[model samples]
Target chain A: MSDTTIKPRIEKAPVLERITTALPIALVPVLAVLGFVAIGDPAAWLTLTVAGLAMGLMIFIMASGLTVVFGLMDVINFGHGAFISVGAFVGFSILIWLGGWTASSSVFLNLAAVFLAILVSMVATGLMGYAFERVIVMPVYGQHLKQILVTMGGLIVAQQLIHVFWGPDEIHVARPESLRGSIVIGEAAIEKYRLVAVGIGVALFLAMRHVLKSTKIGLLVRAGVENGEMVEALGYRIRRLFLIVFMVGSALAGLGGVMWGLYQETITAHMGSEIMVLVFIVVIIGGLGSVEGCFIGALLVGLLSNYTAFLAPKVALVSTIALMVIILMWRPQGLYPVVKAK
Target chain B: MKEPLLTLSGVHTHIGPYHILQGVDLVVPKGGVSVLLGRNGAGKTTTLRTIMGLWQASEGTILFEGQDITKLPTPEISRAGIAFVPEDMGIFTDLTVAENMTLAAARGPLDPDRLEWIKTLFPPIRTFWESSAGTLSGGQKQMLSVARAIIEPRKLILIDEPTKGLAPAIIKAMSDALLELKETDTTILLVEQNFSMASAVGDTVSVMDDGHIVHAGEMAELAGDARMQERLMGLSLEAHQ
Candidate 1:
């Protein structure tokens, strides 16, 4: 063999590709400016902007798992909402049990109560996710139609189960005392809980990006997303990887459920189902399996919804759908399509 | 011959409703290149896939070093020291070339000496280490695919059509790479449509018609006899020339 180094021909990506890559992130600020202009009130814009960011973060938390699961496993788990509801109810139950801590004026105690709720909900939902994969997801791996039908069926069953345990009526949830009030900043007032949600969402996004970029497991996952059979052929148990991703994704949805439950100060069996519409919108807008795309899409939906709800309350419901339509028109495959061996 | 490194006796594979491989019996000797030649839809890829356990052999047995591997899952078959380079090259387009190689190494960090040796075999693997596998041209992707298979030492490798769709120059380079690879201790079961490329590196040859091996013999013997090649393949190697 010749000791010659064959340098790869380097070609910069064309202008179109660069623009598409940056479009999702760029849309955030552009939408914010559009909101600022349309609302015509700086204070309202600040409040809505923070509210949208916080809402987007929560949606990102819930939708992140679905996008990954869809990307890697090709499983459309409609029952993912069930995990959210389960987590919310489980977390709320803990808070109810720890009423003393939740009611305490001390920030530490209140935070502790909320933290315990989140931890317990995550564990419960994580285990539920494991069972969900084995029982509901494993058998319907390649059949998309069956996956949708069965997982939807699973969602209905889960809701019924939640109704059995938590009852049919909605339960009132109070944010922990320390997280209840708004923090006035300059002329803008932001809810303390929303700020916390934003922080958690940012942390989760960074952590997910880091893991996918640097870790061995992350490498397998990204590879598996592109070609799962190749990942198996390379001697890694891709099924095991999928199972782990499913469980973690379910846990994240559960965590989001807890946050959202407190944000609304209410919990119900139907809450997860109701949120599923928005979650689906985010996943679709983000591209089916791209996590970064999901985050951006979530923010877009969140801001658009908040802005529309404030500006034209009647159009709020259809605003996300309109956004999805416009986005799909621009990139039919979603914002960040995962390039796989077709 | 020395004890066969891998053997398939009356192997039958069923993919979904299609019974692709009726019975494929093959013997790959311990350390030389064995080329499987066949026309399209003749089950050459299926044979490799079955050996790698990507497609389960519904009936019969696959023995790797005398150990039954017919029931093993794809990952277990790979872990048992068998590597497969599928027809599509199986490069993870979303991942960088380095990530692709790292995933294939599976055991631990890539060996520096082996990496250097591979760089000589396929320079693109080194030059484009940080580049996404998707950016590589078809020929470079094929090179990366083969590089990944040989990244770690293995008992045997099943490669499907390494020279397919490559430019004449790249095919020549690939032929040279395979010839160099033959010098190593690894046993290879290669599936190729290009007779010239097969004749160049193959130590042994097997011809498949419709999933069953119709003929098996020394490559030199097959290469020298055009009549036998025509009878088995319905086309002679001379036809390409």
Candidate 2:
């Protein structure tokens, strides 16, 4: 064959070769974990998987708000974790005040409250998202620096406000009675709340994936993420779309917050502030603008941290940050970077 | 002649601290191509952008179909019988050709005649119906942009650089399609760098320099005046580069 014919073949090989080679590299981590379990302790492996899955789900919920804003509107909302905190508080208040339940209540009644709490918090968070976009975000379009500073300021104000309203004392939120007990599977004894959280997370991931794939609004959102200005030029009021995205994202974070509250059974005025670091780490590790990335990153961080705790409980927290730094060093844009095919 | 489809008077625009359009005055006779010719950054695209409310005119009156649209939003301005094709060939690349067309159709009814007319004008667009718009060649994107503008009941369409960075054959095709568009009731304001392309299709030619219209006349009258193109565009067409 001529050089011209050969050139195309050479160029095509790199793309295919990269994927084929990378597949084994991607499997190495999973296989390594499996091998460690097969030789040593299965309990350790199971514990790591449950912890990783739970963390991954939580990260997916929280990062949905941040990524949606970044992907769709190119707006970075640093105050997102505050929305999660708000959702937690709201859910707790609903269970305590409306459902008339306590830590000792039946799991079925608490479960009902959880559903109702999720509904109320989602709506409330959605409205807050709309208002935040309209009031704070509208004026600073395309000004990333301004958005960062303003949203950070919003976070500070929100944190202080939460402290003022909820008081300094950390409050405890109870899981349902049914979910309080531990389930023994093989040699691993996992709490019912942790398992339930994993289930909720999986459901959320599937639902969000479905909405993005199937709906007209989802179509608009995907298009908007790539080219919001064009979406506006096409005569669809993009402001409204931004608001919708903001609300839905905030609600997702709120849902995550509610879930976290149930898992920890504790809420504090600075609960949002404490988790913001981990949430951002998860988002950055997953990929800044991808949902799937959030899940993967969350899972990696969760499992890594849990395993680290097993190895050295005193320094488990450092493991997630170490993973984040290592990932950044390797892939500056994060794993599974949201790149469009040229 | 019947009332002009679109009219602009003393349209002044400022971007940030820079004064862009000083006082561009022009009128588009109903059902004709009015070309706005200028050097780079001479406010040709800015004039179209401002008219479409992409940048609100600092001072001026833009009337489309005998209605004031100076204070309207960009989407509202588009909805008001006026469509703008930006200089960059603003095609939503992530969307499929069909999806892009579908979104445009949602703006207003895409009459069968108009759709057929466009398909006849550019067959490549029809050929790549299901393909992603980003995958299209530059010339095809230009065709899609122009096609999008004229898809509805637009009294006037403003097209910016319909033949920028295109193969010679595609440029000729675009020029021919634009001329055909003029034959229909659609009025057009064209911003162009290629003088020959403008001259071939434009019924009336308006020359802009430093944000002001320096000359306005018929295509023949303007093209005959070599000094005007040199004085305004800073390059003489007769002289080979």
Each model's TM-score?
Answer: 0.98, 0.88
Per-residue lDDT tens digits of candidate 2, residues B1-241?
4567777889999999999999888787887888999889888888888888888898989888788988888778776777878888778776777667766764545677878778767776677877878778787888888887777767788888988888777788888888788778788889988988888888888888889888888888777777877776776666622
Pairs that collide in candidate 1 are: none
Model 1 regions more than 4 Å off: A3-7, A339-342
lDDT by residue (A59-154, candidate 1, tens digit) is: 999999999999999998999999999999999999999999989999999999999999999999999999999999999999999999999999
Residue-wise C-alpha lDDT for candidate 1, range B1-241, written one tens digit per residue: 7679998999999888898998999999999899999889999999999888887889999999899999999999999999999999999988899999999998889999999999878888778899988899998999999999999998898999998898877888888888888888998999999999899999999999888999998999999988988888887878876
Instruction: List where candidate 2 sits over 4 angstroms from the true fold.
Output: A1-14, A17-39, A98-108, A312-315, A336-342, B108-120, B225-228, B234-241
Question: For every model in order, what is the iRMS?
Answer: 2.2, 8.8
Best by TM-score: 1
